[model samples]
Target: MLDANLKSQLKAYLERVTQPIEIVASLDDGAKSQELLGLLRDIQGLSSLITLRDDGTDARKPSFSLNRPGADISLRFAGIPLGHEFTSLVLALLQVGGHPSKESPDTLAQIAALQGNFVFETYFSLSCQNCPDVVQALNLMAVLNPNVKHVAIDGALFQEEVDARQVMAVPSVYLNGEPFGQGRMGVEEILAKVDASASTRQAEKLNAQAPFDVLVIGGGPAGAAAAIYAARKGIRTGVAAERFGGQVLDTLAIENFISVKETEGPKLASALEEHVKQYDVDIMNLQRAEQLIPGRDGALHEVRFAGGASLKAKALIIATGARWREMNVPGEQKYRNHGVAYCPHCDGPLFKGKRVAVIGGGNSGVEAAIDLAGIVSHVTLLEFDSKLRADAVLQRKLGSLPNVTVITEALTTEVTGDGRKVNGLSYKDRQSGDTRHIELEGIFVQIGLLPNSDWLKGAIELSPRGEVMVDARGETDLPGIFAAGDVTTTPYKQIIIAMGEGAKASLAAFDHLIRTSAPE
Candidate 1:
């Protein structure tokens, strides 16, 4: 039981006391649990001793009514409040308790008028140690604004919830029940999103605002690359993206990308994002473009976001990349992290000395099988086609590996798993029409990728495969519009190729701007 002083402090901190706060202990030891509970109670008691005054100062006033009336704030700690994470939690609590202004005076005034509650849910895995920083930043925002409610859900512990949310990566955050952002972020960037969301709401309450310039769609390699170039070229640039890295974040190691010999997808995305920050680019992560229209000038374009805000750009660059097609068979999504994986590099190391299966006969599949054979106990390569579609050299190399077993003309039908994790997969022989199941600990899906240009529709001319068409200089059919990287109908989708396209597009856009500005 909590002491009177501690209970009073907890009550004061809570804006609404509709129900008693439940404390769930994650500690395994019984003795340790009791010790931790006592420690928490002590901390609560200490918190009550401090009082927040309106004069931007804290007073030692002993009162249970310290909370301002009508305050509807809530704090959510996603992980165990330990180590550096504890400091973040404390800061968040202080910001919430004091109701400090986190935005500009105008922005704060606008946010204060917001009636609807804004909820932010951040999903994180325990393996990702970098997630705590994001959790702390969100907590602080919730603390500063009474209208904001923040919750952090553990990705692994709450597998069902994670699946429902489609949480593929760690440190993923959602705003108002929709996917909002991902990866680790600083307090300022987090607060900026909150402000942006609030501002959008405020504008909706009113009507019509000026459109933005240089709306660079997508947050992956091409989009980020375009924003960096546009901003550096003295244009007001804004990047609207569903996620920061597109499919690139899903990759584990990128060896083919030039300059960097070997790097992880997440690390590469982070570096590219950092480069964009060096310029005046406004990166709006977790924001999706729902519609596009031609601007008044006919040469420019306008993009409307899902959040009810619109941006206008003198030039538009479609950089939305592709997503790997998933095997929608049963138990596939359920056991995604447990055994079923798409990227061999991201989760391959975890299955060392275990039986693993690789689906598809493409270059990616053969490469994954060859890589896994070096680490795992056994590697089974399954190909739906009669012959491997990979390069001759790769096909020969994969066949030469003694540990790799090739199953030609095999198509996966089902992924069977114990309630907790995957145990094996069921497949069918395409030629013989025989179905079979193989026992394995891990499965890697390496099917071909689908371009992300479906959203463009006929607004931009695309290839038969739905890839944006670009010229040698990365110029699209439309004047003042250009594209680059994998999203375009470029022959190569490698990292180096994408980076080269990005550079070429930047030069093209710069040249266009210069030519148009010169006196005739």
Candidate 2:
């Protein structure tokens, strides 16, 4: 099933196998089963340490398990894992063959120390870019902890199972047959949920760290740039982020980044992290900044975290970034993941052949409508403005799609749901003040982003819209404190602009540090 070039790459990767591994396939006399078998055979031929077996009896035919002989690991895939999941399959092979994981030592320890028996089943679609992270995380956990078992199921292939479970979203995870979560989650996020004391322990550890010369509060493009620039100055630099990559992780396509012709969000985010790691920057992931306490009376600046930990630094650069804006109407939050979604690229496949609505007329909205038109049966795009704000090229592409209908001067009012899932939504005609509702199986919100500056409301000078007010030097109203990226009043919310602002903020903070008196 793999091309010759792919086989060559797989063979090179299989060279890292340090232990005997088996691909146990549970197949039936079907085309899909044959395809899966062929893929497994190709993988098995890549290395001598790997073997294939088809004499398995799994309830789900065409399923397979990756196991190390005599090991208690339980990792299985209920369908042929291709598309974005192909990476998950490759990682599973390498990890099951005794390759060490790249996760933090503390995270690995936490997984290994878990005591309870946990069985996880994640429903995913082939086209979903966010599903691989969840699938690979659970697979790694299963390999690390014998008590943990994970089975990644393709929702598209197993439609009956998806419908029975009411899985209307990608990366819908279940623990012990109960809904656990439905979204893009990494290993740290998953561990924080499973291990209740993890946050407390992490907070305690963070509280004991020494003060940094420059501390970055986010891990998006801006934060990564600030961390790298500060670290390169031969000073102690640290980055505390809720989730490394921030809103960029949720972004799909990024074509405007300079130098790079085209790239995906996750790939660019990974590159940013890797580049930051090349320096002496200390990255603290999964740490949310709750409150910012500016330095006063020669005291160091302290940033409190939601987990009850606080970090102190001489100067702080806030790049907390922004999150997807919600319609904030009735039943919107109630039916989230059930019928309401913000990411068209991630959740579009789940609503294949179903009617959906795209909110907004900007570039994101137009792009989402264009992308979803091919997957969904029909798309109704609603814009609050009189005219679409997207580029002419995008508007032309959206207009050419027969399955999409664009409606201007439309204001979303309420999301209508059938108690369990969304059935439709109500909107108001801005021009005529007439109320209308459209029947749709899903609603993708692409309005815009809301700055994550709510916590800084009373701490700093904020604009009317809650964005941090900063000068050209990226310096905020408070001395020795700066803000960058979408969280600030920076004009455009672009990745390149964010990085440049971050670098400027870092330089400004460094200059402030050397020019002013040291902390007492």
Please name the candidate that would achieve the greatest TM-score relative to the true structure: 2
Tens-digit per-residue lDDT, 46-114, candidate 2: 999998999999999889999999999999999999988999999999999999999989889999999
Candidate 2 — which residues are off by over 4 angstroms?
A: none
Worst 10 residues of 1 by lDDT: 56-65
**Which stretches of model 1 miss by more than 4 angstroms?**
1-213, 295-299, 328-356, 361-380, 386-406, 414-425, 439-443, 514-520
The pairs that clash in candidate 1 are 96-143, 212-312, 214-313
TM-score of 2: 0.98
Over 456-508, each residue of candidate 1 has an lDDT whose tens digit, in order, gives 78687889888989999888887777888888999867766776677678778
lDDT of model 1, residue 193: 67
Candidate 1 positional error at 274, Å:
2.0
